[model samples]
Target: MIVMDSKAQLTVDIIAKVAEHKMTIVNAAKLLNKSRRTIERYLQQYLKVGIQFVVHRNTGKAPVNKTPDSLKRQVQALIKEKYFDVNLLHLAELLEVNEHILVKRETLRSWAHNIHHVKRAKRRRAKARKRRERMESPGLLLQMDGSPHRWFGDKKSCLIAMIDDATSEVHAEFFPSETTVGCLKVMRDCIESKGLFKALYVDRAGIFGGPKRCNFSQMQRACEELGIEIIFANSPQGKGRVERAFNTFQDRLVPELRLNNIKDMASANAYLKHVFIPQFWQSQIQVKAKDRASEFTPLPTHINLDDICVIKEHRKIRNDHTFSYGNKLYLIDSPLKYSIANQKIEVRNTSKKGFTAYFAARRLQVSEVVETSKFDTEELEIQKKLDVLALAEKLGNISEASRLSGVSRDTIYRHLKLVKEGGADALKRQETPNLRHKNCVDLDVEKTVINFSLEHPHLGQQKVALQLNARYGLDISPNGVRGIWLREKMNTTALRVEKSLSLLKTA
Candidate 1:
């Protein structure tokens, strides 16, 4: 009749047996793995208070240091309403600092699991990783990485971030996609604010150093010029700190963005810098080093950050002191302009400042030519079309060209058609507006198509189109559905084929 756990019930039975002279106190002590005095105490309690006395005195009573139910409820309410996405450890710190309610991470986790039924999916067991020691001071090393995630619900974005190896302080900016420009901007912002770090620890992404055999990428070249050493991680685990930061961002940042209604990269970047980062640091997630002195070096007086951080390309200055970049001719002017004719010059272009020409460490005045002759425009347009076609030809497919250039297959086809009919000049000609045709489907329909393709992955274009027509009452051609699938990079057949081949190999 005792409503108790197995251990408690066993203790009650043993006490009853000892009291009835069936079991000796010494034998009961041995059975219960307790001292003789403890066994005697339990028997005495049973004699005084009956079978209920066998239960521990603390049973059905809260501990002296137990958090109040009201406080626990307040913490749960705050977590659900405001800090729903924060991890348990961070939530505990936030509760103590912000809400003045002290709680351990384990306690918070237990409360959340029992009261709120909050659960996280178990991650796959990873290989054993060797832990890397953090640097002793800030700026000794900076770990840099890019995380491409659905920061905004509407679209995916790449967050280029750099974190101090010692302090774990992070500086990140959201970009449309990870590129050299984004990396440069993130590094520039970091350096301008915190000074230059000794070295950068980054992955061997194409934007960074790329393959060992290839020439230095723009980012690598810029880092070399700035006297910053680039250390490439042999594996993702080597840069675990930055990778873990990205994990936190995926967990917390997305929900914060949703709550704040941040839809664009600009707004997301601002929120990340001004709000989330500050709050994150305040949560005391980053541990402070013993030595507070920073190892970051100040910018040299002779060095120009703009020049070091820009995208530099070598071009030959024409006889007229003009150089063409991106199909546009730019004229370089200087006191020694005539002397500099036919000389190889470096064209430095930045996102903020347009373009500047430099030769042998000397900056030259550059201006874009607004006026273009008909023959020149025709020639440039031809060259541009030929370049696009050449890239497509090199890749051996329009899909690769579209992926690399961020151009649509339709545009590539249109350009190729123009090249076939009227040569390169045809590509330069303005397209007449098609007033009759309008988009049959909106963004919602496009999202629906994408979702359906993901859910019913084996369904082909024709079936998908038919399903959409039946479900949404919107008639869409098979080709239209195919285009949508292509844009989303959802080639289910190829994926299924690859998966089958992998399974076969395993078998």
Candidate 2:
């Protein structure tokens, strides 16, 4: 006699046919390509048809203990209000300690969907694309991005961040917009603090490179003056280092901000400089320096970083031992003050209050007294109106007046008196938008190089040159393009290997 689960009656049916036919068990086994014993067991299940027939064999054992309900609830709450990007294991650890629950990971994961009520947001992964793998030595290449998040925890301001590709160190500042001015400020800060990098790698956003114009932008000119190469990624993936860094920052940084209770940009930046950065770099970033020597070299002594980084102007002391800055007259208290009227002096303005005045390195004490003048007050109001109109016009809007002079409505309001007194010339002293750079490259060469790189990322100079000549119309030497790309800091990734190899040999 054979016996089997009734739920498997279909297989038993076939076995019953052979048994009902009085066929030998060997014959049934041969027909089904199964063991004789297996067929016999199915034959017995068919005979017992009245009750207990359709049960699964393994249904009775209880499942392993599940994660506690209270623990799951707490994790769900933390994820809902904080640490949205933290992964499963990190969450598990937090739950075990913070919620005082020791739960198995498998059990915890089983309840994840039910607890959270939503699937985790999928993080963007960089897709593999056909492009040259470019990298540079530490401090050689820097990547920049603008994050328009409420970084200060008060929903207040947007921050622009610049990170070193080799070390993942950040130089960030809060800005009103992700504009060229914001980018230039970050760049100026980096250059002043770290000296000139070999090149800067940035996205092809409008702020970074203008409308693909033939001429260089004012920002580009400033970078060129510093001998810093400006390189634009062909696509966002090319600037993946900075993009991914921001993702990680969005994860861990928010909690840090909450812990410190940072509610404003000034306090947040101060925390970043003092508490956050030192701990972050030590914990996360890998050292990619060539050797034991420190990668960052100090800035040159002669270069006054403060002077280069700041927006400055030349002024002369007036007859009343006073000087004017942005329409405010500040009286100077000089020890030898008979009268220093018409003497040339320098004024340095920063984003913060308190402008510094100097005469050839001599600090001049500014009088705290408020001086009121009719002409000064009038000029101030005129400037204010012009600024408002200028800002409105920049957004591609119209002024109240019917004119295509690109003047803002606020500008019209600011210079309404000025326009009544003078003309459009009163409002036009040259309105520059504090732009500092532009993108410049030979289109033909760029195409040839980019195409060759797509085919062979690790191609040597000679091989790339041959491909360029054979396929593209360019007849340039391999060394020529190689020099150009290297000079621009675009090929630093490949150069790092050679540097690493050299270091290994020395070691």
TM agreement with the true structure for every prediction: 0.60, 0.51
* Per-residue accuracy of model 1 over 303-325 as CA lDDT, tens digit each: 88777888999999888888899
lDDT to native, each model: 0.83, 0.65
Candidate 1 — worst ten consecutive residues by lDDT sum? 432-441
In model 2, where is the ten-residue run with the lowest total lDDT? 433-442
Q: For candidate 2, write residues 241-292 as lDDT tens digits.
A: 7877766666666666775577777777777767666766446554554433
Candidate 1 segments whose C-alpha is farther than 4 A from its true place: 1-84, 93-107, 115-122, 257-261, 264-267, 288-294, 332-341, 366-507
Error of 1 at 10 (Å): 8.1
- State the lDDT at 286 in candidate 1: 78
